[model samples]
Target: MNIRITLDGKEIETTAGTLLVDVAADNGVYIPTLCYQRGKPCLGTCRACSVRVNGNVMASCTVPVAEGMTVEVDAADLNDMRKALVELLFAEGNHNCPSCEKSGRCELQAVGYEVGMLVSRFPYRFPPRTREHVAKYIWLERDRCIFCQRCVEFVRDHETGRKIFTIDDRGTHASIEIDVALADRMPPEQVREAAELCPVGCIIAKGVGYDKPIGQRKFEVKSIRERTLERSRK
Candidate 1:
């Protein structure tokens, strides 16, 4: 069954129970996502995909499509809010993009560019954090983590289904933890998967850095919007 909803004043027809993010994307509307991976359970952890539906703000990935719903994805106020959200993330963490290895390929950085964030309105936290290089294949630079929870929810031990990355503490003091036993046993592919799953440079694969170079990185060649919209076109 299909449902019709008005997105940014354009009527979009999509399957019932389809996430608003997917519905918008299928119709060429890009909702920025930081913690969403297609086919995975919606975590709603990042809240980067927040959009107005029926005059109320909600995470697009967590909202299901319904008939006659009015969504405001391109509204100016929402865009401002989105930019502020990006800036907050920048200010919250120690994201020194210039010196970070994930500078160009980082989704958080790309989203910052997408939202036209020149500077953060809020003061930078610059919270003290510790780095861990316990695993032979991977390292954790805790300073740059945005607490997106991707590694905690997605990456797991293949044999025991135990989480390799778990959250420690709560709220502002919360930190990412690794199950050393499981992390050490991770296969090479899983090692790569964990590194790639992180949206920032917090999760570093030990041996490689600056592999793609400055100009030839993921978002350096094309904007995140262009990359995503092109995928929808195909």
Candidate 2:
């Protein structure tokens, strides 16, 4: 059944219990997201899709629309909050965009530009993180990982149905761990899929390096906003 909701002060009719983020997107609203992928279970890890629902701030990807729910998506304060999240990610991680392999296609970089992030307000930690290239077909660039868990949750061992990528430790010491044996056994296409699944340049295929020129890259060809809205509608 279709239910009416107020999104950015505009009336929108959508299916009841549909995810708030999808509802907004289907109605021509753009909510920046990192961990939440459409048609997949919501991870709510990134918290970039924050929005006001009935005067309460929450992750829109994890929220379900209710009748007459008032949503504020285009508010200045909300945008600033998202901007801070993006900036903090930059400050915490070693995202050297110019030198990184996924500079143009990286979602973190794209979202940062979308949120108007000139520079991070927080101090850069520059934590010592080592890049892993031992896996036969994949490279784990720990420095660029934002811990979105898309690979850990979505991409799994095809036959065993076990998590090929897992998180080690907890809190500040937490790190992403990949099963070298499992990763090696994966088919070439699956390896490429896992690499592409990552939001940043963290998990990458070994053989492929700077394959597409800068101008012909993913985000360069079309803005994240355009691709996101196009995907959401589908």
Highest lDDT: which candidate?
2
Candidate 1: misplaced stretches above 4 Å?
none
Q: What's the TM for model 1?
A: 0.97
CA lDDT, every model vs. true structure: 0.89, 0.92
Predicted model with the maximum TM-score = 2
RMSD per candidate (Å) reads 1.0, 0.8
Ten contiguous residues minimizing lDDT sum, candidate 1: 225-234
List of clashing residue pairs for candidate 1: none
Per residue, candidate 1 scores C-alpha lDDT tens digits across 1-234 of 887899999887788899888788878888888888766789999888999999999999999898899999898999989889889999998999989988999999999888889999999999999998888788999999989899998898999898889999998989988888889999999898888889999999988887898899999899888887777667
What tens-digit string does per-residue lDDT give for candidate 2 at 106-181? 9999999899999999999998988788889999999999999999999989999999999899876878999999
